[model samples]
Target: MTMILGFPLAPIRGVIKLGELLQEQVERELRDPAAVRRRLEEIEQARAAGRISAEEEAEAVNRVLRGMQT
Candidate 1:
């Protein structure tokens, strides 16, 4: 029966649904102005601390900016 076949797939379905929810949350955060500003600030702090090179800082900044566009 359909129910019998679906029973075995319930866990897989649940996992997929969870993944989708997580992805949505991440995308929502990426588009948030406050979240983007915080991320940029973190990158700047890392650069100031010499934890990342200038090029690396530029790349990280670009990546964060690009994420906001999407």
Candidate 2:
């Protein structure tokens, strides 16, 4: 079971559950300008430091994102 859209509860998993939570978190984080700014800065810093290339950065972001997916 999962609590979705901040709703009481629902028995769901995988894409639906993940998508809802991601969207919710994204919206909430979007409201926090500083946090979003910091995240972008961190990503840019990583790119500059050669931790990730543009392509790798995209993949790495999604990989970290996918960790939260399920």
List per-candidate RMSD values in Å: 1.4, 10.0
Q: List, residue by residue over 1-70, the lDDT tens digit for candidate 2.
A: 2445645434454668899999988767655657655766787789999987999778765644554444
Task: Quote the RMSD, in angstroms, for model 1.
Answer: 1.4
Question: Which portions of model 1 show Cα errors greater than 4 Å?
Answer: none
Error of 1 at 54 (Å): 2.2
Residue 47, model 2: Cα distance from true site in angstroms: 0.4
How far off is residue 39 in model 2, in Å?
0.2
TM-score for candidate 2: 0.40
